[model samples]
Target: MSTPTSTTAWVHKTTIKPTEKFIETLQKQDLPLPTLGPKDVLVRLHAASFNYRDILIPRDQYPFPVNWPLVPMSDGAGEIVAVGPQVKSFAAGDNVMTVFNQEHQAGRHSIVSATSGLGGALHGVLREYAVFPEYGVMKSPKGWTHEQAATLPCAAVTAWNALKDIKAGQSVLVQGTGGVSLFALQFAKAMGAFVVATTSSKAKEEQVKALGADVVINYNETPKWGEVAKKASPRGEGIDVVVEIGGTATLQESFRAVRMEGTIAIIGYRAGPTKDGEKEPGWGEILGSICQMRAIFVGSRAIAEEMVSAIEVAGLKPVVDPKTWTFDEAPQALDWFEQGRHVGKVVIKI
Candidate 1:
């Protein structure tokens, strides 16, 4: 792990260059120590994780919003080193995570802005230190490490928002063992909902089952995983919630599997629909016509607060493994995430 020097560190940072020459052009440049804003908290970062969005930024293909020469990541966890005078919710030494949308602190719909997000239009937390507004920070649950807490803001919170209204004894179907799906399974089980999970790899079937999934469907073995998911739910009652991470690849099947009025949280496009002979509908047609309601992104800060409370109340712990990499190994960590070998969240220790 990289250590801090002089209460500050020589941080190796990543940035985007418009030349499109090579990603290496965004090299390990030195950044001056990060400073706290009046209502901001300066966090001494221990670890940060990569999301699909992080991978897309370097390739110049990310769909959301961004700017160049930006440090690239939205999720991170660390101890609070200093808090501005007006901050009272958290103090120095508290382990906390910064919000995905820095500007939108509360409510159901977030007001998206270019300057608020990390790793795109604004500076991200790939460095040894990061400063965030106190309103965007949340104290991590007791007994969770910085690495584990780092995975919550993006994928995990999206899962929580997706199933927030689900009731006890209801059923949920998760697409695969990716970050959002796996987190959904654990959370849903703890909510007293029966879970049906799927995986292309047989090796991960038992692993999903052990995570409290009532049924694990090996999609490789059964091509129609939607049918399997239906059968697994009691009396073919169908799923009340579906954590839809496969995007176009599983959208049609998701439509078939979910009960009428059930909700699907569409989170990713990694597993595209055209692959494996799955048919994909045009987004314009599907958006207004097929699904009655759709949630495009994670909920607001108020939702994040509710999720933290539910997590504590249910004693739900996020599953994360530290993916430590020396300053030189950052590229390899990104490559591994691109290869999709991880069962849980992947983090880089700086």
Candidate 2:
């Protein structure tokens, strides 16, 4: 394959206020492709998926400072077009997906590996072509589309990590109907765990049930939905695991819903953006609940590989939103995601 001199990329030039349009801060420009390193492979990205964190970056809501003119988005899959001298794991024409953190290969995660994430500390794969270290990309699952594979790195991996230890007959409670939550529902059911899902919209209840949720709680109607979830557990003991995405605003409920010695994986902060001059809610009853609460970043490359194998074995297909978008329609896709109407992962085909 011939290497191209330049490629198109969407660059976030500046941070914007919450009320402002995110697309206003972005500019598409033709950039000269960087020289490949000894262990680098150039990928022609075919598709990319959006995450909640991607929206937060341009709004200055993310913890990290803006890497100006940054290419945004961490999850993508494509075909490799070129490989450098020492690249042996992959070759030209292989389909591959990006790992969220380039340095997190296996075992425990640390500050170093955490800082090596794409789309924030490093350049992301929101462009037509991207250069990645040989270890930074993994072969996509067999018989999956690039768009489907693009959804795996962040949301799917986070769900996999959260439920990896779950056993048959255990109970899992998931909040909302976002990418991670839906993935959690699918994985929990595949693992033979009874799944209890919560959503604010009554209209989405059926969709949740179709995804294998044993019970669906409308948090809107039942404000204390956590207690309801606990009571719904077998023998009314409480949920074995809670996929808690709402931080300060919803942790109290998670504490209420989780049983003694249950596990709560704090994966996201959909309920954050705390009010001005107000600290996050105190630990309150969390300590008394006697549950294990851990924060979940996206998992390692090894975990992703393991997840792919499991997905292949089970023939699990990720539930992507029906609405498809062209690469130029990224702004529209972001707007659709921010509105919070989509029931599953959103994708943009390049």
Candidate 3:
């Protein structure tokens, strides 16, 4: 491993408190390198991706509770430089990635203990170097880049967890052109499931179709895009699974598109109210609309491992866009992400 640098990262200060509006400036730090414990491994982060939850948590709309002045990202990928004495699963040359639940390393949700996520409660990987417990990291598949591996932990695993039991030839409905939604499209297609993806712009209709979506609906052209989604399938049967990302603006339509006894994974709310003055809908109304199969947050590490295996077996490739900034340009990257024009994942190279 190379010598640890004194100027390893750019840290962001608490722009907004826990219950305030969004703030976008990052405060740089000249602090010493982080020290590792006996059971820890230090990772030099190469790239980190943005999630809708990352954008909303700082804005104080997300339900996941967290502290201020925290590094705000849940997904990252990097290489291990140093390992504690007790560590045996990895070495200095190993390329590993972090998981969403630090304690839930490799099992179902019930088997794992509840620990705070990296970018959730504790300091996150927006920094250049982060120290993680040996259990929280996993070995990346051979030949995958740090950026591709970094995109998997949260959004990719969530899609895998939602569709793990789905049989081949089943149908899934993915909403919009976001990170999680795109992962749902790719993974569902790899699983041999018929996919129907939605977009507000007709120009993107061919984009989703190119990604193996059997049907594409322009929500802007047809306010009831769900009706169009239903007609795309055989016998007018509704979709067997719906990856519901639109919280209030399109939740009822998701309900209308789902088949009886089908599943809907409520991963995120990317297109809801942004400002404080706008009127927000009620939860009862939202839940009342999604009167379908069980709804879940994300999957466990076991599910994540299953996803990795599937991706490797099927040669699945993550739909990553491009890096617009480096570690020093974090504030700009976050600002660009808030605008919501990018198609795939927006990453920061550290």
Q: Please, what are the lDDT tens digits per residue for candidate 2 over residues 163-254? A: 99999999999998889999999999999999999998867998899889999999889867878999999868889999989877777778
Best by lDDT: 2
Cα lDDT tens digits for candidate 3, 242-279: 88887766666777787766776776767674345433
Which lDDT value does model 2 have at 43? 96
Model 3, which residues run further than 4 Å from truth? Answer: 1-7, 15-24, 31-34, 106-115, 273-293
TM-score sort, best first: 2, 3, 1
What TM-score fits each model? 0.87, 0.96, 0.89
**What RMSD does each model have against the real structure?**
3.9, 1.9, 3.5
Better of 1 and 2 by TM-score: 2
lDDT assessment of candidate 3? 0.76
**What is the RMSD, in Å, between candidate 2 and the native fold over all Cα?**
1.9
After superposition, candidate 1 runs with Cα above 4 Å error: 1-26, 33-35, 110-115, 276-278, 281-291
Scanning candidate 2 in windows of ten residues, the lowest lDDT window is: 273-282
